[model samples]
Target: MTAAVRPPYRVGIVGCGAISRNHLEAFAALPEAVVVAVCDVDADRARSTAERWGIEHAYGSVEELLAAGVDVVSVCTPHPTHEAVVLASAAAGAHVLCEKPIATDLAAAERMVAACDAAGVRLGVLFQRRFWPAAQRLRAAVDDGTLGRPILGHASVLLHREPEYFSSAAWRGTWASDGGGVLMTQAIHYIDLLQWLMGEAVEVHGHIGTFRHAIEVEDSATAVLKFASGAMATLSASTAASPSLGISIRITGETGATAELSEFPEGTDGRVTIWARGGAIESEQVHPADVDPNVDLAAINGQLIPHHTAQVRDFVSALSANDGTGREPAITGSDATAALRILLAVYESSRTGSPVRLNQTATQEALA
Candidate 1:
């Protein structure tokens, strides 16, 4: 007997917002995937996106998109509404690739994971920065002990968001919808990568404030993280800066080895410096960030498309096997949940002016 051949995977995208363009572009570049349908609360937006992308179908709601059927669904909706869309997609027998933050709260994040697990479909998050070349190299060094016994780590995210940026979207800059502020929305990529390269966060102490933006959430925030591996790290994120410093992360090990990486605005170019004990530290520019500012779509796509495409490829590959052997996705629901746990702690710490300790459990209590 021979195994049946699988058909090309069908993809449906929920929420036709600006971020959806990157998802569409990434999927369009992959032959294994097809964008059959798209849905947004705005019917006109969905119709326009469907026409622009040459998608086969367009719907006004996620319900309609799910009913039409797709092998994989990308939840591009707001951070708060991700849980509902993910639950429905998983129940519909579709694997899900959700955008960052996972959900507004830990309970909702837990529920999304449970629903997908019960449905027996794969779930992945859109933390594309993990796929960056410099990031990958650093991760390899950490795993291989090139950076022996990680002891210290730090990551900073400074981005400029005009008042109109948040005010334009009613959901933005709200605890109920956008989650926390810069930490949850803008800096989550670095936060996820920091935890990924360093280790799990066991304790967090931080402070938050809405310095620039007149929104409810904190535009400027900072946190200190203590990893389970005994590594101490600090995080700072702000949308209040005049010029975006992009993301800067540095990890120092007990052996005096260090990895420093930074990315600039609009995803132009980044520098990586790696130093191993007893050897000359070498640095080089990676990930071509040289992009035109005026050409917004091209610039965004230039950097995002490749990274997003890489993640999508990994997700598709994970879907190809059921042996439960070596096909695990690079980023899973549990991983995203863990990242959300840290963000929640940062918020809780800021709210209460104390440190929050995470118990040794996969589903740790984050909201308390």
Candidate 2:
């Protein structure tokens, strides 16, 4: 007897924006998956993306893409629009791999999760930084007890965004469209990583301000998190740094072992920059000659293709496997929601001038 071969999974991508290229390139790298269609409100952009990627179909709406038939749908739209795309995909019996933050608000996030659960389709979220080799090592240390229960953690995301970056996109800094600013758009990745290593966050006290950018949302923000395991973490993120400092997350264990992961020059491969265990300290030997402040979206997306491909490959494998040995995606809709909850809490805490407790029923009305 021989095992039967399965056909390649059909993929459809919605929203042919700056991030969509990463998803397209990722699927292109996987033989088990083939992108069949793409959709965008801007029909020309969708057709252009399809032509550039050698995809067969391009449409102007999610409904048309769903009608064309797809096994998996990649939601790459802006923050507020994720819900409609995900819901439509799930309703059409397609598995969804949505871009980060899940949704701009908890209410929408919850509905998306519930819809997928009810439809019996998998819902994966893209927190591709988790695929970084350095990030995996830090997670392993905490899991294998090398980090001794991760008592404290800190994540700093100091980078520069040009004024033109926001001006080029109408929704870049608005609370309604892009969600929040530095914390929502940029720091959410590290916040996800921090919470993954530390544990479930129960509360947060935070403040936000627009120091440099003239946008409606905060260009700088700070937050303190209390985890379920009694671990504490502090997060400070800004896009106003002159030369772009890059991102670093440091963790200190109960046993005093410490490790730091650094992603210099932004969007590049992250390195375990610091490690101290058993009175021995190790540090990264090589460092970037200069950090580029002018690194743009296209370059960053190009740099992140490898990580995105890793996650997309995993997602396709999970869908392909049917012999009872299949694994769920590294970041599920529910797993991604944890980070969104924490960030939303930070917004609430900032507005109320007090620590906000993590509650399932809290709506995002306060964020507005």
Local distance difference test values of all predictions, in order? 0.82, 0.88
Model 2 deviation from the true structure expressed as Cα RMSD, one decimal place? 4.6
Q: Who wins the TM-score comparison?
A: 2
Every model's TM-score: 0.91, 0.94
lDDT of 1 by residue, 104-220 (tens): 788999999999888878889988888888888888888888887678898887777777788788899888878778888877888898889987888999998887789898999
Q: Encode model 2's per-residue lDDT on 1-368: one tens digit a residue.
A: 11112448889999999999899989998898899999999999999999998899999999999999898999999899999999999889888999997998988999999998888788899999999999999999998888878889999998889999899878799988999999889899999999889887887999999988999999999999888777889999999987887889999988789999998878998899999999899988434665554478778889999999999988887776644565567899998898999998888988999999886443344222
- The window of 10 residues in a row where model 1 has the poorest summed lDDT is 286-295
- Indicate the residue-level lDDT of 95 in model 1: 85
Candidate 1: residue 127 Cα off by (Å): 0.6
